[model samples]
Target: MASVAINMDENSIRGDHIASSMIDSELHECVRQGNIDDFKSRVQTHSAENLVTPCGNTLLHVAVSYGSDKIIAYLTEECPSLITTQNSQKDTVLHLAAREGKDSYAIKSLVESNPSVLRMTNEKGNTPLHDAVIKGKKKLSIFLASTDPEVAYYNNKYGRSPLYLAVEKGNKKGILDDLLKSGASIPIKIEDGDALPKGKSPVHAAIERRDKDILVKIEKEKPELLRLSEKELGNSLHYASSIGFLEGVQFLLQKFQEGAYERDSEGNYPIHLACKSHSVDVVKEYLDKFPYPKEFLNNKGQNILHVAAENGKHRVVRYILAHQKSTLVKPLLNATDKDGNTPLHLAACYGQPLASFLLLLDNRVDRLIVNNKNSTPYDLAAEISRRAEEEYAKTDEMTAVERKQIDSKNSIPADEIKGKEADTNKIGGDYFGVVISLAILYFHACPKKSLFERFPVIKRPRPLRGEEMKSLLGNLLVAAVLVAGVTFAGAIQLPQLRDQRHELNSTSRNSSHENLLYGYLFLDLGALSTSLVAALMLLWATFNYPKFQIPAVVLSTAMVCLAIVMMFGAFFCSVKIALLGSHGGFLAVTIIVVAVMFFLYLASLVFPWIIPLSVNQILLQVVLHYYYYIYFFLFDYSKWWLTHKLYDLKTKFSCY
Candidate 1:
C-alpha cells in the first residue's frame, strides 16, 4: 500500500516531470481504441511506454480498465515492467483486471507475466485474490487460489479472508469447491491447531447467508470450523437454532453431537435458543434427540418452559406439557428459577393470561408454592396488574394535563375531547380487561373452574327445534358420505403403470415420473383413511354428547377441512405427474392446495359471523322463536282463542 517513496525536496520536482510525461494524450488514445497497429507505431516513435497517469497509472492500467485484449498483449510483451508497477490506489494490473471482472484474459496475462503481482495488495490490504472472490469472479478466484495457497491466506483490513468472501456470496455454482480444489487454505483453522482467531468469527457470515452448501464445504474440508463457536454467537448449532433453521440445526447436531448441549457464554443451550426463537418443531427435535436434562436451565436459571412462557410462546408451553411424559414435566410446571420464579410465576409477571390459564389448569400445579419474594403465582399476577395500571394511569395523567393546557390555550371544542377519550379507551380497554381477569383469577387460583361454578347459572338455553336439528344432521351426513366415497374410490382405483411405452403413455422414458405416480397413490390412500375417521367422529358427536354439540361440530369441521386438503393434494400431484415430469411441479401444486385449503378453512371460520346476521331478523319470528319465548302457558292455545282468556307474558325468552 505504500506509495513510491521519495524525499521531500524532490517530491514536487518528480511530480512535475511525471505529470509532463503523462500529458501525451495521443499515446494513451491508442490504448483505449485497442488499435494494435497504432499502439505498436506509437511505442516505436516515442518513450510513451511507462509514463505515469495523474493517478500514477501507466497506459497499461487504461488498457486493462477498458479490457482491450490486443492492447494489453502488446503492452505486456513490450513494457513488462507495467505489470509490477503500483497505481495510485496501490492496485497492480492484475488487481485492476480482477476487480473489473470484465475480462479474465487480461487478468491471466498479468498473472502469467509477473506471478509476484499475485502478492501485491491495494490500499485496502486486499490482494487480487480478495478482489476476485469479492466480485464473485470464479475464474480469477480459482486461478489465484490454485496458483498459491498463500494467496488465499491473505485477509483484508476487516479480517475477512478470500474464502470468507466466497462463502458470503452463497453462489449455487460450486464456488466453494473451486476454492478448495485450488491451494486455498480454509481461514478458520488458526495455528497451534486452534480454530478461533480471538476475533470475530467468519463462519457466522455463512450462517447469516443461510448457505448450507458453504457450511458443508467448510465442514468437509476442515471439520474443525464446525466445532468452533462464533466468539459472541455460540457454536454452530446454537447459531442455527437461534434462526430456526431446522435443516441447519439438524445437520449440526448430527455432525457434532457435543454441540447439542454446548452453551454459549450466556449459559444458553441449544434448546434455550430454540425456545427463544419460539420454534416448536426445533424444540421438539431437540427434545427427541437429547432427552436428558428435562428441566435444563439457562444463565438466569430459567428452564426451557420458563423461557417459552415468559416470551409469550403459547404453543411451545402447551407442547412441552403435552408431548413429554407427565412424570418428567410435572416437576417443570412448578420448577423455580434463580429468583424463585416458576414458569407460571413469570407468565403472571408478564401478564400472559393464556399461559397462566393453561398452567393453572393442570391439577398437579401447587398454586400455594411461594417464590423467593414470598409471592405466589396469584400474588405476582396481582402485583403485575397493579403496576401496569399505575403505568397506564400515569400515561393518562400526562395526556390529560397536556389536553388541559391545549384547551386553555386554543379553546378547542369540548365534544372533541369527550369523543377522543371514548376512542382512546377502546385500546386501553383491551389490555385493561386482561389485567382485570388476572386480578380476578388471583383469588380463586384455579383457571379450569367450570362455567357454572365460576358464575351463577342463569336459565339454561332452549334446545334447537326438530327441523334445525334434522338439517344440521343432514348436512353433516352429506359431507361425511361425500368425503368417504371419494377417498374409498381413490384407494381402490389407484394404479401404477408397469411398462415403458413412449408413444402410448405419459410415463414413457422417465423413471422419476413413474415414482411420482406411486407417491400420489399413497397420499390418496392415507387421506381416505383419515376421512373415514373424521366421518365416524362426526357421527359420535351427533348421537352422543349433544350437550357439547358446538365443540363437536367445530372439531368435526376442522377434520373435514384437513381431509379435503390431503385429498386435493393427491389429486394435484397426479395432475402434475401426468403433465410435467418435474419435482418443481409438485411444489406448485402443493402451493395451490394450501391456498385452497386455507380459503376453505377461512370460510368455515367466517360462517359463524355471517350466519348469525342473516338469522337474527327472520329467526325471531320463526318456529324456533315461538318455543324460546313461551316460558309459561297460563291458558291453552286452543282454549285462549275460544274463551278469550288473558295471559301474562313475563319473560322475553324461556329455556326448558
Candidate 2:
C-alpha cells in the first residue's frame, strides 16, 4: 500500500507539469496572432521567465518577430526585464528588431526603453548597428549609429567593423557619412586576426574598391588615414599598384606623393610591385611623376628592370627599353644586383625566355658580362638546361625501374611460378623489355662521361634571335589559320548532311547512326577550336610583346598536334556515315584502310621519341662503367638543318 501511494503521487505531479506546458504554448500562440486578451489571461498564472519559447525566445522576442506593437508595448510596460532576453543565437529582442523591423519606430522605442542593449553584441560579436547595416536598414542604421556611435567601432568575430561593412558592402554613402560624423572610426588593424586588415587601414579597403570619390572624401574628412600604412600591404598605394588599379594609383599619388617612397615589409617599393605585376601604365605614371626614384633598388639589390625581367613582365620591359634615351633609366638596362647578375643574367637564370629574347634584341645590353658564379647569360642558360635534362633522366629511370619491379612481382602467382622457365619468360616478357634492350644497345655503342657531354653533334639549347622567332612563329600561325579554315568549313557543312539524312528516312533513323553523327560533330568541333586557339597563341607570340612566348609556342604546338589527330578522326567518321547502308564487307574494307593509315601516321610521330626516352633509363648504368669513350651516337638532323646545314648552304651556294 505504501508503494502504490507513492506511484499515485508521482503521476499527479507529472500531470500538472504537462498542463503547465500546454498553457505556456497557448500564450505563445496568442503572442504570434496578437491576441492581447488571451495573452493577458494566460500570463497571470505563470512567471515571466516561464513564457519563453523552446529556443529561449522570450514573449518579447516573439512579439518583435511578429511585429506585434501591442504585445511589445504590453511586455515593455509590464515585464521590462524580458527586453534583454537573448535567444539560442544570443540575439536579443533589439537584434531582431534591428534586423527584421519594417521601420525604425520599434527599434527607437526598444532603445528608448533600454539604451544599453544598443551596444550589446550577439554570439557573433555583432551589435544591433552591425545587423542594421548588414540588413540595409538605412534609417535604422543611421539612428543606431548616431545614437551610440562608438558601437560601430566594435568588430564582429569576422574582424569587420560597421565602418568596413559600409565601405565594402553597404552601398549607401549617406550611412558612411553618418557613421563617420558620429565618431565611428575605422581601425587601422584588428589585433591578432588572420583575416586582412590585421594591419591594414580602411583606406586599403576603399582603394581595393577603386572608388576615387570615397578616397577623396576620406582624405577630406580625416587626412591622417592617408598616412596609415600596413606591414603586409605597405599602404593604400602599394595595394593599388600591386593589383594594377590605375585610378586608385592616380588618386593616391595625387593626394600624397610621399607614399611612393614608402616600402613594404618585404622592402619592395610601390614601383617594384607595379613592375613585377606587369602594370605598365602604373610604371609609366610613377616614372613620369618622379624620375629620379626610378633607379631605386630593392632588398635583392634589383632595380625595376631586374624585377621585371626576372618575373617575365614583357610589357614593362619593353616600356623601360623604350625610355632608354633618359639618362636616369638607361643604366637600368645592364644594372647588376647583389649576385653580380645583370638583368639579362637574372632573366636567363630564371628561364624567362621572353625577357631574355627582348634583352637580346637590344644592342645596348651587354650579354658578355658574367655573374659572380662566372657564368654569362648564355652559359647560365646552357647549364640550367643541362641540369634540368639530368634531373628528368633520373626521374624517368627511377620510374621505369620501379614499374619493372612491380610488374615482375605481379606477373605470376606464387603457385604458378614454380620453374626457372617462368622466370626466364618474365625477364624478356614484352614491349617494355624490348625498349630496355634497345636502350642498352645504344648506350654501349658510344659510352662516355655523360650522355650530354658525349653528344658533340647536338648543340646547346639557345633562345632564338628576335627575327628568327618572328619568322618561325609567323609560319606556324599560317599553318594554324589554314587548319582552322578547313575545320570551320567542315563544321558548317555537317548540319546539312544531318538534315539530308533525316529527310530521306525519318522512320529508319537508328540510334547508332545518330551517335556516329554526333561523334563526327564532336571531332570536327574539337579540331576547329584547337586550331583557332593555336592561331591566336601564335599571333600573340609574333605580334605582341610576347610575355609568354615559350609557353605560348609550346601550347600551340600541342594544340596543333591534337588538331591533326581530331581532323583524321573526323574524316573517318564522315566516311562511316556516308557508307552507313552499304554492304558489310565494303564498309569493313573502308574502315580497315582508314585504320591502317591512322596507325602509320601515329607510328611516324611515336617512333622518333622512343629511343631518346629509353636512353635515360640506362644512363646511370652506362655512365658508371664507360667513362673514357666519348662520342656522339644519336645525331640530331633537325638541329643541324636549323643551325649549320641550311645556313651553310644558303651562304655557300646562292641557288645550289
**Among all candidates shown, the one with the greatest TM-score:** 2
Per-residue lDDT for 291-378 in model 2, tens only?
8754578877889998888776877887898784568767897778777888876666565544665677688888678777786665
How displaced is residue 86 in candidate 2, in Å?
3.1
Q: Clash totals for all models, in order?
A: 0, 0
RMSD of 1: 26.3
What are the TM-scores, per candidate, against the unseen true structure?
A: 0.53, 0.57
Question: Which regions of candidate 1 deviate over 4 angstroms?
Answer: 1-24, 34-57, 68-92, 102-106, 112-127, 150-161, 184-215, 388-656
Evaluated against the true structure, the overall lDDT of model 2 is 0.70
- Model 1 lDDT per residue over 65-174, tens place: 88888888777888898888888899988888887875457668667778888877789978888897888777767777777665565566776666667777775356
Model 2 misplaced stretches (Cα beyond 4 Å): 1-25, 35-37, 77-84, 102-106, 112-116, 185-201, 229-232, 390-656
Local lDDT at 229 for model 2: 75
